[model samples]
Target: MTGKSRAPNLMVFGVLLCLGLLFLVLPAYHAGNLARIMVLAVYAMGYNLLFGYTGLLSLGHAMFFAAGMYGLGLSMTGWGLSPVPAFAVGVGAATLASAIIGFLALRTRGVAFMIVTLMFAQAGYLVILYFGAYTRGDEGFVIQQADRMIAGIDLSGDAARYFTAFILFAVCFLGLAWLVRAPFGRTLIAIRENEERAQMLGYDTTMYKLRAMIVSGAISGAAGAGYALLFGYVGATFATVQYSIFPLLWVLLGGAGTLIGPLVGVFFMFYLIDISSAVTSAYMLIAGLALVLLTLFAPQGFAGELRKRVFAWLP
Candidate 1:
């Protein structure tokens, strides 16, 4: 609608073009790394919809992500479903899980709400881990060899798998870009700014929040499915609290609420980890130190601070 609002979309196009070119020029091994970065970006954007727009800070996003990953894996390995159907099964399970959690947690507010979500997510995580027969516990389960292919496309190939991730990321980027410009997205922002005021104005704040949670969960779930499909592995790590912090780190580093923030955040951290891993096994220590410095200096996040100082004139 305005120059300020359109800036993010323009940035998205530029970034995606750069990513495409990077994949084209880089070796397949490196390109696959970029593809994982794309999936992580999708995860961060989904979380941003709730944290950046609706002002909901959830620490249990791993529950939703794990739902999708395990859902797809189990569907294919145990239920004998094809790749596409298994993906849908994973997404649906995540959406439903998020809805249930949102419905129950919305009863509280602020700190209480955050704790409620964390508890629920933790309990679910434990259940998934203990039920080794279904999820194979920490070892995880892989998709059946027969169910790995979709129609004529051989997803076993790294190139095809990376392309699949690219397409999913591109479609999601476009969809989320359009969403933030729509009326529904605007309402989430309004709720975020002042929930009580929105309620006074006759908007159902709870319903809007629930919808945002479901949407966020579904998107994160889809990313999880893509991840399992790409790597052919679904493990307990994806469901842990440690993993949930990753998207938060990405969003804060790149700037929450900005459409391109997740992309920048993912690229920076992904490369940071990738490069650091070659030299030392303690790469996470390096990552943690960087995050600490970012917290001290750029607390508003890279994208948020950029807009405040440089792009203040933009929408």
Candidate 2:
């Protein structure tokens, strides 16, 4: 590949290599934290695809995440399906939910779209509660270690879980980086920049947006499914409004519309909380102040600012 074409591949490989090395060098506790961060980063990347790239802000992504989590959780707990099939069912559930939500929500734009999505998510949460007997509701249910295996590998183990998360994050990270450089990805960007103009140019903006939403939701769901399988827990908290807001925070803090931004943001936020909580009971206050400072000085986020000033080829 030419230098320009090779840049993204090299960058992705470097990141994966760094993560692999860290797994070997870091202490067990931190290694586990990094694994969780990687999974959460996958979720943030999904959010970035729609918000950062397509300019479609959502407030109900937790529903898609929950859809995948519960899909896997219930399929295994209720139906006795194996982890592998249950994982597919979980992702498929999120995909279907996104397709349905996108079909309806894309009909509106701006704040209206956000409201519609939030409403749908709220409904999903309520439905999960209504079927508390099956779901175990807000208290949630746990998957035993036996059910957390795939192809004879136990995901419940620390190393297996960590590497599984690593693989999931790497695949999604590389896939999205490549996608954003493709023609379809560029078309979404064009629509994000000027939907009317894209429509004038004879492109189907709605269709493109719908497709973006489905892709975004699918990735988010995968993260959720992975979390349930690896972590061995499925709970209502993952479906709450706070969960929906998390990816937005991660994307904005790292840098919107940039490939590495999600991972950077996830890592920063995770450590910020980790270190702060150790120092004082009012960790959130410190986090809030830090975020305010970042907003004032680095509005485009850490990676966004870095891309702007230093590595123009970042992505």
Candidate 3:
């Protein structure tokens, strides 16, 4: 094909893809669930920065995720703040919490670090659970219809909310892409490969690890904000230990080392869960078994394997 003809074809394809996505989202679009998936994807991306890129295993990321959600929920419900400001507050709280946690967690390495993070997260969960009156604890927080005005546009409609979330996801995704390609990212990879060697080269490994933690936590908080806005509710279940593991699974399932892998993993898992639930009541068992099979047979995950097969056939 000529270059000029190819350009037009690509443009048409892009437009078609966008239209298709819009159509799919429009009909089955539950504001709450869409928000949940988007935010969960964001949350998983943050974990990917640590586990996928940095090779850091954290078992307590849900602490920050919950913190962000509850922080937004409390601000909007208790203080009558707007979604934007409330979300910012939630991000701040999660960031600060992560900073403190990172400081302590960074002191250890490897499995010890994972254990420390898990313990901290569990402690956070208990704290939220015990304060039932303040947090509504197990009952969760109900979101009320609050005015969401952005540049003269009232974002009360489901479509508006979905678009808002898509915008946020795009921004975060782009930002992460840039971050992973930066010099700092190279240093993180080095640390992941050999911390002792990175330290010998004067790369303050601890500082890099802590920085990653903060970035991951902040992004997770941003995701939580999206969740709160989408669902108009927040609760303890959001921060459970299981939520933390899912992101790890997503990264691994999608080919962790690559940038687009987590997204591929999310889409695959979402559809898999949707289809499996429709087929049987024992969806969880099936999902678990699928994960086991994926892990056992496709260690590099589906994306990595697909890429290899496609490239092999091309040449």
Best by TM-score: 2
| Model 1 regions lying over 4 Å from their true place | 1-6, 144-146, 313-315
Q: Estimate each model's TM-score.
A: 0.95, 0.97, 0.87
In model 3, which residue pairs have backbone atoms overlapping below 3 Å?
Answer: none
Q: Tens digit of lDDT per residue, candidate 1, span 1-315?
A: 587767766777877788777877999888878888998888998998999878898988999999998888888888788889899999999999999999999899888987888898888889988898888888877765556788787886877877788888998888988898799999999999999899999999999999999999999999988889878899898898977888889988988887778878988999998899999999998899989999999987888888899987322
Per-residue lDDT tens digits for candidate 3, residues 204-238, read 88899999999999998888877877667789887
TM-score, prediction 1 = 0.95
Residue lDDT tens for model 2, 1-315: 388778777888999999988988999999999999999999999999999999999999999999999999999999999988998999999999999999999999999999999999999999999999888889999999998888899997888999999999989988998899999999999999999999999999999999999999999999999999989999999999989988998999999999999999999999998999999999888778878898999999999999899878876
The candidate that wins on lDDT is 2
Q: Candidate 2 has what TM-score?
A: 0.97
lDDT (C-alpha, whole model) for all candidates: 0.87, 0.93, 0.78
Report the number of backbone clashes for model 1.
Answer: 2
Worst 10-residue lDDT window, candidate 2: 1-10
**After TM-score superposition, what is the CA distance of residue 89 in candidate 1 from its true location, in Å?**
0.5
